[model samples]
Target chain A: MKLSREEVVHIAALARMSMSEAEIEKAREQLAVILENFEILKEVDTTNVPPTAQSINLQSVMREDIPGESLPAEKVLANAPDREGDLFKLRPVLE
Target chain B: MTDKYTDLTIHSAHELLKAKKLSSVELTRYYLDRIGKIDQAVRAVVTVTGDLALRQAEKADKLIAGGKDGPLTGVPVLIKDNMCIDGIRTTCSSKMLENFIPPYNATVVEKLNNAGAVIVGKANMDEFAMGSSTENSAFFTTHNPWDLSRVPGGSSGGSAAGVAACEAVYALGSDTGGSIRQPAGFCSVTGLKPTYGRVSRYGLVAFASSLDQIGPLTKDVLDSALVMNVISGQDPKDSTSVPETVPDFTKGLNGDLKGMKIGIPKEYFVEGMQPEVDAAVKEAIRKLEELGAKVEWGVSLPHTRHALAVYYIIAPSEASANLARYDGSKYGFSYQDTNNMWEGMEKTKQLGFGPEVKRRIMLGTYALSSGYYDAYYLKAQKVRTLIRREFNQAFEKYDALVTPTSPTIPFKIGEKADNPLQMYLSDICTLPVNIAGIPAISIPAGFAKNLPIGMQVIGKPFAEETIFKISYAYQQVTDWHKKTPKL
Candidate 1:
């Protein structure tokens, strides 16, 4: 199952990665090789088999919801590449 | 001067520190100097926190003086870059997190700090632990210490190589598939992947949440047990952390495997595997039998061949979701050469992630895409159940399973770089252990030429004691774990 260039580009878009034309060309071949590896799974009979999301069995562990100290905003924003005072700065979503 | 302490394990370092034979600062300096002098060739360490290590060493000296020393006190450790260390650069070897400094320490880091372990450096890895070799690191690839031309099996390559090169007493590595064990095998160190949820993942950078597990790569089986004793515990911060009481893994280190039952999975011995790996593991099995353990061969894991396919689907799907948080808006690198938030996110990730990471993200995006979710992702999860069941059935009759840690010895750099599938195949033997969520360890079994071949010992869920028992017995019968690479 080879991925067409358009399909690879569309998948990249959905993944929030912008690929250059060159990268799209490269992705076409690499993604095809990988997807072909997955094609072997179609031969397996998984009918009636239950899905395993987690290897270990555990219910959602809940704690008492109470107010506690959060990380200081300054510390949380320390790694932000673009930030205003106490706020993360981002490009406008819509023009 | 030859740094004699460089070859000391964490256990011996702690003993000497307690005896005042070696000061923590002096020991820490020895490692820092070794890394500075030798790491240029191996490229194992990404960031050397010398000042921080000295400060921590001073604290450890105080603890030892005050008779408050813990098991890891004064022992220098290299942490995989993906794990957070408060105020330290935890890059995950990705450009996106290149400048990321976590405000809080990961649970394991905090535990190590409390034990007075010295933080030496952050080791290089496959970018976000996505690849089988450290060649995927955006900054640089780590080379095997044994042969500088060859690649260090990776994601945990730096951690394993660091220990092998005597740059660190021990190191922590996370295994999503074979990241820890494969590297340990290639670099000729001992590594353990605790049962899934056995170690807290609170501060680890998420890769594939379900498959990701933190483990120790040490110079020997005993050091692995010693580190495991300190790191394995439940944490409230990680919801997936198991509540089972962590055992003293060292208690099972009597090296007695009398009457123990070990199964050898026939499926793991495929054609095209290195003849050396097959022979070394078989010899290790003979050694196990000589050590009084009953070795059973020809056990079949029928679904073992499907593990690579299932792992590619499940891991990427989870990684795609987990990595979505890396968009430029909040933390990490942001590309400003865009008009809007969406483009900013796209452009930042496009430039930030390496080629292998992008491939995985795209693969995951496609697998979990609207029309293909059921066909790919869901089906893979169901098959994951089948894979897990196979191990369960094997464990019913055997105390543990043994196999080669990797299919081949360390290959030359760029040998498998262009072929991603070939790189992925290096993990074929190790992936089934993770999918089964059982504890497994890779210990140096013997040498193939000069490179090391690793044998994996796998145990049932949360059965680390059993795995340790088998590994320790094997180590006792052989000196492979003691043969450090002459750098």
Candidate 2:
């Protein structure tokens, strides 16, 4: 259950977050205790259990295939942190 | 600035409004002014919608004048900050969404507006609904109304505190692993987490998607039902919202619990539970039996022990995926100083998210990572099926299950904040309900030293009416719901 500092950094990158050296140490300590708690689940026998899916026990719902009123581009971009006209301005993905 | 309308439930308020004894604007102002006067100390509200409330109230008065009003018409209510309010910022108590004003209303907001309920303001919560206390809110911690020193159990802390303080008639809260019920228990208000699909999730800021559901927090059980009547229904916008018949939640509330079978899950009453809370819950069970429900004690849901493990895994895994959208360029906060998008995204997340949120995302990333998936995420899902099956079997023999809503009464504000595991343990009693995706209601059962203890009434999937009926019946014989904090 204990994660190494490198492992914590890797997980942070996977989550699209960066951690300082201090945060990595903090995360390692907290996540180790939490992950160790996961050991309790190992005691439960689930030899033939099927995982619950996104579509739950309730009936699968489908709406009519038709167009409906939608938010305008301007409205949708109202909260954009970096915007140009209706488009969101962004840093280049490639340097 | 105090008025006669303070602490009025929706039912009484509706009666006065119907009799024209009070106008909607007056009632709205009463709440708005009260919130204005006392909210500084309570710290429950994130943003007070005084201007919008007045405008909505003015229109509601016209509806009442024309005799076209509904139960919730002109009733002022607070919404948990996670739910979208068009033009009003939906911060989710996270800096990431600190300035994010959704363009469209969440389905519940639309329903409330349609029912003529005046939006009073947004309530504070744990950032991204990640913690059991409002200490995690980037804005400020919402204090318990009963005692300013105690923590209001959270992520719906603000909503519960607001209702308990009479800041609003009722409020909406989203529950994922006890977010709604635990706080309701702490604050001595009634809160309900409906069947996962009973209420629409569209426009609600996603937490653990499968485990998350929006419900009501109110001064009484019936107020929860009144708000439920307005908010519950199938929405085409959210595919998970089920196509179930919406019942008039207020009807049959006074009906006796005769012949109804109630189960007491032994797993819920664990060691280390506060003596007062334990005694109060057991006493509440006796009260239910006195009301004619057959109580079956020692009913075992054996898989309950693994629920906390399963929840941490499943909830965070889903949240990790759900929260990936906060990339900074489109909406919400973005770190703009980076030369590259990758660094920009990373810096945005590192700076935008709070500790608990970051911890969850990392935990989820690790659980779902290639080598660990089977050992963590997949295994948790399989165990989730077992946990749910245990509830399914119990429901076959009982109409509902009764349990303590929280292990302890509201603790000191800084008591568990530093210890993450202890804070997480605050939700142990309430997590299994969200795991099983069933309906559960927490109502004030009793009190200890001026703080309230809540008892949870859990029901089968899509069985909101059954739980509501049981809760309302319990409320009839008890006056716990009648007690309010003398803040």
- Which candidate achieves the best lDDT against the true structure? 1
Residue B344's lDDT within candidate 2 is 91
Model 2 lDDT, full chain set: 0.90
Query: Per-prediction TM-score of chain B?
Result: 0.99, 0.99
Residues B1-487 of candidate 1 have per-residue lDDT tens digits of 3768766987888888888998999999999999999998989999999999999999989999999998899999999999999899999999999899899999999999888999999999999999888999999999999999998899899999999999999999999999999999999999999999999999999999999999999998889988988998889899999889988888978878898999999999887999999999999999999999999999999899899999999999999999999898888888887677788889889898899998889889999999999999999999999999888988899999999999899999999999999999999999988888889999999998899899999999999999999988888878898887777
Q: What would the TM-score be for candidate 2 when compared with the true structure?
A: 0.98
Q: What is the TM-score of chain A in candidate 1?
A: 0.87
Q: Write the per-residue lDDT of candidate 2 for residues B54-147, one digit (tens) a residue.
A: 9999999999999889999988899999999888888999999988888989999999998998999999999999988799999999999889
Query: Please, what's the RMSD in Å of model 1?
Result: 1.0
TM-score (0 to 1) for chain B of model 1 = 0.99
For model 1, the local distance difference test gives 0.91
Could you tally the backbone clashes for each prediction? 0, 0
TM-score of chain B of 2: 0.99
Interface RMSD of each: 1.0, 1.4
Give the lowest summed-lDDT range of ten residues in model 1 chain A.
A1-10
lDDT of residue A33 for candidate 1: 86
